[model samples]
Target: MSKLTFADMQNPLFLHPSDGSSSIQIEKLHGPEDYRSWRRQMEIILTSKRKLGFATATVTRSTEDATLGDQWDSCNNMVIAWIHTNLSPSIKKSVLFFTTAREVWKHLETRFALSNGSRKYKLNKDSYGLKQNSTSVYDYFPTLNVIWEEMDSMNMLPIITTVSDEVKRNLEEVEKRKGESKLFQFLNGLDEVYVPMRSQLLMMNLLPSVETASSVIQQEELQRQLLSNPRHDMEMSAMFSRGQTGGDRVVVCKECGGKVHLSDKCWYVVGFPNGHPNHGRILMKPGSMNQSWSIWNKNNPGNKPKPAGNVAGSASNAVVFSPQQLEQLMQLLPSLSKQPSKASKTDDKLDSHFSGMMSYHNALNNDLGWIIDSGASDHMTPHFQKLIMPTLVTNLTPNIKLPTGDTVAITHM
Candidate 1:
């Protein structure tokens, strides 16, 4: 009770962080390069704890009483210790012996904080020079914002007391101009690939703020990430392009409303390229692709090529079944259905058997970039090597058979 001071009653150390040993939970300061960000964080923590006054030298020791003086000294030591805990090993050694919180803070400031002119010049230079070169928009946007924030801090508008409509309007105009400048800066620094995105943003009527523009660009980045994977996209395209390949994973295309390809490098949409059997012809269309072709065909019907008749000697003659032969085939179909096939029937038998089995052979056409296989197969792939990243299903259902005159079911689909 005797050692208790009036300072304890008015400005209590209980509200402050306990001591230097009490670690500041923040990104530890490295050096001058990290000083600005570190300082901003430190200020927030110190201010909340009411110990910032000690660092600033605004909270003074009482000369009138020894008890109050001791209280101030203890608080000052605590503040000084808190700062030290956040410093790098190299920086800690230099300020380790500083007697007061104010002295430590001033020494660090003098060592690290750049002069207004130099810092302002550097920040301005960074704002212009900063580009989303090789990095993602998620990573690059934040870094650009950091530079802009520092620049804004350096060139803050002056506070005015006399309020007027004209002043308010003029201030708003200044803000709009500043926003426009930031928007341009953000768009300009994007990689050349995003020219379409940048153009779209710029073409907006009211002109979006930097924050709005950044959000749009970030979404674009995510879409770009999705579109960049050629394997996934090409696989997706093949689902509809050549035929169905069995998989549960769904691929939906934004352009043509097709289920498989974002590589709307899609054979269905773009049609087959040169050398492909379906070249210069629309192979398949899922909605939009069909509509587009219909419009194109209607617009240029003369340019569309007519299908060519097969040359007589190229393959074989078309067989014409007599009424007697048709009756004989129908009688044989019933007897064929009961017998299990010992050997895997050829793929053409799939339709003949009326049993839905298909040959899961990888007749890979490199020109078409997809395996020509129907989805109604007992196995997804005939070759073991094609199962590059296979997931085994443990729990089993009774294997469904396509009534193939002969379909050999393998262990893995």
Candidate 2:
């Protein structure tokens, strides 16, 4: 048997003109994981360049013509060059001495394509198991389409039709079913909010194209946005409207004479009629009707009719005085006497005394002594030193009258 020569592998009739076009730049295969995609891309390039026959053809040496031998060597070298440029450096050593493209191609196939069954199994599992989860529809469908296309190319997907039709109706039906399967898978991966839309799609006699379905889903998303944001809808409406008032209109409050007053802020709601309860009432000289009413309405800029005037002997009316009112009036006379008919001056002293007393009481510490008193009718202190946390009572009137007609001065407690 004679060893094969380059002439025997050359095809004399094969002719292809050089066009000075760049080679298709397929990505270099990194490892076993990249084999399938790399192979697909390289095959496309080889076919387009009219060099696929060189890669697929068997090498044999039956003739030794010098011209044929040179042509064969040129074709083989071109194929080898193309293959070598597209291989990663790590895998180059194994195929460095390969004289024919077939050898290199076959070696790669044998080494990496061993896991085809496992690859097919994994692809099938992934295709069926894919879910939208956190992925958006735009992001998710492309991935699914890629997987579907890969499966179809591998002949891994089941054949839906074998019978022939003149118009290729059977083929169309197969494609339609494939589209529906993809649509169903996409819908399944969607959130439950799309359940109604999914049902509508499923119920249709013919499913919409994926692009159409995507558009509908996008519209659904817009509708969802509009539904969730009422303020946004209102703003959009307002933008389209012709100079309409956009928010709650301000109305004049009848009671407080203010604009946009809340019901809670209304004088009537706050338990004050005729604006404020204290607005038109006299604080001193409860018995004198004429003098009190004159002073009460003196500051009224709007001459509004006094509601208290009609109800005689009402608390706001000058003729009325309860026992507590009478006592308060008697106490006011001394304070008023010092200022002699100047009510504002008398009010200042009264406010100062009450405020000062309240401040003093609040300042007192709450820590009480542990000392217990038994059979005591009245509170008593044995000595000042025995009072562990005594607070000095200051600036108050000296004496407090007891029920037994005795008055005692409060010093410290």
Q: What TM-score, computed on C-alpha atoms, does each candidate reach?
A: 0.54, 0.46
1-413 per-residue lDDT for model 1 (tens digits): 47656685446454434345565677778877778889889989888777888888888888999987887888788787788888888999999999998999999988998888888888888889998887998888899888888788778888999979999999999999999998999898999989998998888889999999989988988888888867987776766655643555666776556655675566766677789887876444446434644554565454442222233454232223456756756976665676556334533353454332222332233322333334332235445544534566655655544444255445554
Residues 249-275, candidate 2: write the lDDT tens digits. Answer: 545555445555655676544654566
Write down the lDDT that model 2 would get: 0.64
Error of 1 at 30 (Å): 3.5
Q: Count residue pairs with overlapping backbones in model 1.
A: 3
RMSD of each: 20.3, 18.4
Top lDDT hit? 1
What pairs collide in candidate 2? Answer: none
Candidate lDDT scores, in order, read 0.71, 0.64
Error of 1 at 233 (Å): 8.7
Model 2 stretches astray by more than 4 angstroms: 1-22, 58-68, 114-117, 156-169, 218-413
